[model samples]
Target chain A: MTNKTEKKGFSRRQFLKASGAASAVAGGAGLGLFGYEAGKDPRTYRGWENWEGVNQVFNRKKYAVDQPTCQKVGPTRRVDARTEVIFYRRGSFMRQWREETGLEGMEPHIQEYYRKNPEDLELDIYSQEVIFPKLMEDRKKYQDQFRLSDAWSNAMGAVSPPRITEPPEVSDFPRRSRRGGSTEPVKFKDPKKTSKLIKKIAHELGSTLVGIAKLNPDWVYKYTSIGRGFQSDEPIEVPKHWQNAIVVGTPMSWDPMYANPNYGTSNDAYSRSRIIAFRVASFIKQLGYAARPHTPGTDYDLMVPPILVDAGIGEQSRPSIVVTPELGLNFRPAIITTNLPLHPDKPISFGVQDFCDHCKICAENCPSDAISYGDRVEVRGYLRWQVNTAKCLNFWNSTLGSMGCRLCVAVCPYTRKSNWIHKAALKVTADDPTGISEKALTMMQKRFYPGPEPQKYYIPSLGGENASYREPPWWLRTEDFIE
Target chain B: MQFFISGWFWFLEGILTCLMVVGLKFYMEDKGIPMPFWKWILFGLWILLAGFTIAFVGTSLGEGEPTAAKLGGILFGLTSTISGIALWRILLTGRNKT
Candidate 1:
């Protein structure tokens, strides 16, 4: 056995030398040395330099392309399905302004009043909070009367059985062609006529929110690394056919989602992104114009932040998430870079930068501490809060098995549902004219959506398929983008 | 030489060990009081142990003399000891609690 004194004692000089040596070894080996290499990412914060070589080991970088290009447009149409458009009525009692003692007088008698009038009840149900408990009671009574629990059975007092919308066919897949093929950019007979139609088409394609923005050169990545269609530079002189870009966001199902923030809980986000991209791409191609979808799974050509900013979707927040009015940060974005020539939505100034200045909720709840509570700094042309991708990626690698983490998206305040009441306040706060409006909105959001408290870490699971808490599979590589 | 030089060995070793620890920890943390200190110690020990285990298991099952068998022995002993200690700590902790 070694002598205890010699073996156990660690000198400051020895520690320093060891640390320096370790960092040097890590940096040379392509590991970020505890995120020391975050400096390499133009959009990242310096504080993220903690996890040295983690970024190299776990990130799915093999998919990275040296220069990313759009896929070839093929012949396909979008499959449409009649689906329930869930309109959520947030529990009014849960709102901050109201105190709930469950008292008789406090129970909004307005529900009982509407129950008497069918015409009034339908109107009230659209805008006002539906009496969920009453509905539950009525459902129970009906079930007991008919002695039926089958959702498809109308035998119960239930007037109509629950029905799913008809799903679209596989033929609806979007057409693809190699970038700049024989397809002349679909010409719009009139620019004014096209923009309005494009906006309307975007909504039908399952985009909860859509905005048109002029494509800026800065928004395009300095270089592309992954995905289909290869272009080295901005195609020299831009094609006159392509002009405006459409930014779209698909919201996640809040019920299955609010339960956890682990990667498994985030499967819904990816699935939604795929669905929206597939549908939106098909819709654009059907219009006989060129439209390319940018999804995390599909591309490295364009940056989402710039597209989102130009489209006026939401203000960038401190946790480095896009904060939209309706979904907060809970949405996964899909971009359709097109030449349809549409009216551009001006980026709005929602004191989001200032709100994020004071709000560190995501940072507080981040189990990996990937988020920074630090002030925003200049990156390229814009000033924004940047996370340590190395740290974030490392945590994702550890917790999510293969998918990586979406807890930042899960816990953001902007991710709240856009209820009627919330919409009213959002409309007022969207402009954020004076800094005062932003301050008020932040206060209101803080009051309504109290930030998560720090507690022991809990690993949220996605039930069976992705239950193994293993690192990602070998295929999905984020490291291919690192170099 | 190529294996270690390429860093694939270390990378694979680190990843395997990390996965094992994190996977076990995920299941274990939910069961009872978190044995934080013991877990930390076990975490360090397993890296050394698992690394050698991979090297050793490869050799013993294979047809040739293990060129890295000396280092392989060290890895095996370290892994065995660490796993034993980790199990021992867990058992002892559980026993004391009971």
Candidate 2:
């Protein structure tokens, strides 16, 4: 035998010496008996087989206003307008700060970024301190390599609606004119029927998830932004007619989204989301109901996660993005406000909070270390794992293209793609009364799916190859485009 | 290390070690070889380690981490089984009269 290493390491006699000893212990515990059968799985939610956590509507029957699940999330608090992070160009926190502090008072190096993008939510002191300096340094250090990264991101396609301040005309389906009280509004005698129709319309319009929730004024931004943009100095109030909200969510394209910070644009899913919102809002308006679509990135008036929770879309996970059992963290949303009188869906629970508590893969894989490693904290009266956005945005802009990162989104165990096998695993994980399967599954993710170190995604010295979850698909092929 | 698991090299190693350990026991018993008390305990540990490695391998295959996790457990499991067998053999040759 040419395999001397094996031959010399263990002779036939040596093998005989060991197996005899092993039989005693191996015989005691037979290997064939300790597995599970999907058919006989004890995990059923309300007798729903293999659909334990499949739907996004976790808002259980007889929904609790204060506590969605057995877990006490604490007293719910409305987001204060004064402290809310406003990303609209006119109402941006940086815009307010610049108006008050003046650009002359700003650091000269970072003044360029704000001047170029005043409404950018990430344009803050952290960008000035950590991100801009790195940008300037990378600009000089890896000129063509940096350009290549930008080209690769651009080749995947630019995130649409480049400017946050784009007028409502971005939606081609605008209402004919401002609605008046002079005409009797078209009434849906049965709100439940109308809601069902709206949901069907949303799906037909390409929504992956849709739900009706009464507008929670607490989630609405109070100060810098308004229900609509272009309002000047006067503090604004939500119009009385802005009552029921229709939240439409779209899943991000699978291959590109799984790539995360490397080739993925965090905003890609939102483009589709916003389109669905525009269509749904237009449908409501044509039916003679007052409707206003809050475009995802460009024109939303409120923080999204809480409203998503209220709408029964999903529960917010550790990264603070709402994770539905259907799409996990892969959903992007657009909200339409109207007085359409739809039956409101209550908040849901399907063990997302519980799954998040045990599965720290997102926290462990975060490139920016932006995701919280600690337990959920009560912020503004709601319980959540608060992401340090400063750390997150800094890592995002530090990358060459300034394409935002979704490393958290990509790594989240809940973000599993829907398939029969994954669905079975998810159901087991969701309804495992013993929690044994969840623990084992979490262990599998932690052990088998190791990703590269954080710096590999952005650090020019490292060449960023290991950054993607898998290689870019054929269209995003680097060699075909770059070389 | 990664390749060993990815290629299922460790599973081969673990299974071979387990067979070798168990095979040696029957051989000794067939020849009426008088192993000492401490050697018997050492022999039991070899089987125990191999049994656990096989259990992890079984669980990994069931849990849908078929390649790296399953093969990796088997690979490292071989190391533990080999060590137990080696220690058991050393105990058999030891000067101590237990």
Q: What is the DockQ of candidate 2?
A: 0.15
Candidate 2 residue-wise lDDT at A320:
88
TM-score of each predicted structure versus truth: 0.44, 0.64
Query: What local lDDT does model 2 show for residue A367?
Result: 71
Candidate 1 segments whose C-alpha is farther than 4 A from its true place:
A1-187, A231-242, A286-288, A400-402, A424-455, A458-483, B1-98
lDDT of 2 by residue, A101-203 (tens): 6656554423554576554434465566456676677767654543544565454345443334533333322345665423336767799999989998887
- lDDT for each residue of candidate 2 in B1-98, tens digit (9 for 90 to 100): 22222335445545755675567655655455666677777766765666556555554444344563455576757787679768856755633343
Fnat for each predicted structure, in order: 0.00, 0.25
**TM-score of chain B, candidate 2?**
0.51
Q: State in Å the error of residue A435, model 1.
A: 5.3
After the best TM-score superposition of candidate 2, give how far the Cα of residue B96 lies from its true spot, in angstroms: 45
Error in Å for residue A159 of model 2: 9.0
